[model samples]
Target: MRSTTEQTVQPCPQCGTEIRTDRRFTTWCSACDWNVDPVEPDERPGRVERMRRGIAHRYGERLLAEMTGGESRRPRRDVAGVLACTVALCVHGVTVALLLAGVLLVTLGWGGALPVLGAFLLGLAWLLRPRFGRLPDDAPVLHRADAPRLFALIDEVAACAPTSGVHAVAVTAEVNASVSTYGIGQRRLLTLGLGLWEITAPQERVALLGHELGHFAHGDTRHGVIIANALHSLNSWRYLVAPIRNPSGLEVILNALYLLPFLAVQGVMMLLDQLTLRAAQRAEYLADASSATAASTEAAVALQDRLLVYGSAETFLLRESNARQVRDRAKRDEPEQGLWDRLAAYVESIPESEYERRRRVGALRGHSVDSTHPPTHLRRACLLAGPAEPAAVRVDAEAVAAITAELADARRVVARRVLRG
Candidate 1:
């Protein structure tokens, strides 16, 4: 017989509300509605969660979501199957063409057809095999000591994934997280950026992890590796053949002929890549649903909001960095150009007149990528207004202005340093 004590009522830790107690673990506080205990202690959540919550509490939810959810997961592919089909098709096509050419050459007492066939085989082989580097065995792990609560939340979310288990986790300074499959079996790696941790909530962090796990569940990691290898092989063949000069007009024609196989292979690979990307986008939606299911609708909404804002800022920073790199390269290439001259040159290169250029640049300053993720304003509006009647979230023009100004200042600093050096 079951003990009645397991069903006894217990006082809510926060608001003094009475709640039934069936499990040994502490649950939600009924009175104040605060969480009484961490969601899952045995599972380690790591730094991604802590950074997310800290960003949310400081900058509000909208900023956090913008930052986290910008990039969707990698697309899915069937590497082995695709490679086999490609090889078989190429061999059959080349063999039939070579045989017909061989008959013509034999009747005319010519010997070049055999060489052409040899070159084609070599090119095809080169396009199928690719070199891959091993991921380091001792990559550093980011400690989650600073955000214990957030880590606990991640563990709870991870626990919900039944078939595939979560593996290693790492943090980078960029605002990104990805799950990669590198080995022969179920082995995988989950990488989260330090920038991701810097700007989201606990719930949002779980959403990010859940999204990554979705990639694993859908076999995207292995597919990505296969696609990458295929692309690499194609690229390698191009590199090898680029410097070799064709001696005969026939060689030039043969070069064009060789391109057909290359194009056919690449076209298929690209289509597969895009298909994978679309699948990844759908996975994001599913992960978002999973997050809502595991936590709450409100929590899922808040997570999305936080990701948008933060992800935008991070992308802006990266663009700024790239611009600086380009500027530095320009300065190195032309040391004689004056600072004012370089600035003037840059302004002149804009597609508009000086006045219009300034205005356009100003307009672009704080605005996030409108095309990348669903607009932050739209996402927020959807969350606040509900899915059926989704509206745009109200954005403060002043806040955008402020962020733009800050980025402009950073740019100016970079410009000064480059000019001085």
Candidate 2:
């Protein structure tokens, strides 16, 4: 209901320091970071999240040590990778066995409940079948004709990384970017998040591209269809076998029947996670190295610094959306033009000291983009510790301008989606 710029100053009860409080955001003491990120009841992590956090902290430290201790920078296959692949193969084998058993029962068993049992087995087989990754039908896609300048930039990064290029590029409203394969053909796709792209400097954008492409270069096991689908199947199996909290007579029997299977699936999932965790971490470090190789160590580290403040960027977007809602309710005029411009200005206004503080906070909390990756602070340190290579693919201001123009329509659509929330 009020301008985001309108703020009041008050003393932080914790530290007795003056802190600016914006009406649209939490009132937090920047000096002491009081209430900066208050823990809400719902924000408390579940058992699985706690386990993942522990794993992240443990392996994050180990990988950081290995990288900084003059260990080979290149990613190599180890026992963990082999075990992970074997586990995935076994999972697939089980699915095939289910299919064959279902077929045999249906063909050979001609009486009693055998037909129904065979059908049940067939259903299980279908559920456990390996899933081929697919692109989201709703997300906007940019082909070479649609965004030649952008594709040129991606191609440049691909060449620099010496990785096979993507077949298509997809854009989304997320505050992240990633690369993955899709379809039976296993065509590579690059997903560029406008939220992140709008704030990145040209060289930083190159670094981002280089980093995602690096995953392909390093053969990130987690991204492979076999492993990815196995993980998916395991999760699905867990969900299917999970015990119901509230069960009636027959349902109670069903729930009791599911308990053993639920525990078994959980154990298998945990084993798969443990086996693959080290290789996944190594893949990330190698990707970061590739990023530094293509976009320079400075830009790679800068990209990580930008990642630390994505929460702030998301907050800014929320505030803007709320402000727009208030204006609409009051029948006050406010055009939604230049949303990306406003976002860029807001991020650019952040002081370097603020970034440093967030980095420290990330380290304190072992925060990462996701549980799969190391802490952002550790990734930044790894990049900084490596050689400061120059950029292999540079996107100049003119190229950036061209690419921005090409993405103009997509930006408007994404901005509308964000504001609508």
Instruction: Give the winner by lDDT.
Output: 2
Give the per-residue lDDT of model 1 (tens digit) for 35-103: 533434445432333333333233333433442455332333456446544643453454445555545
* Total clashing pairs for each candidate: 24, 0
| Alpha-carbon shift of residue 215 in model 2 (angstroms) | 0.7
Candidate 2 per-residue C-alpha lDDT over 28-128 given as tens digits, one digit per residue, 9 for 90 to 100: 67788777655444566755556666777678888898987899877688888898999999988888998998998888888778877888899999998
Output the number of the TM-score-best candidate. Answer: 2
lDDT of model 2 at position 125: 95
lDDT, model 1: 0.44
Where does candidate 2 have its weakest 10-residue lDDT segment?
327-336
Candidate lDDT scores, in order, read 0.44, 0.82
| lDDT for position 181 in model 1 | 52
Per-model TM-score, in order, reads 0.42, 0.88
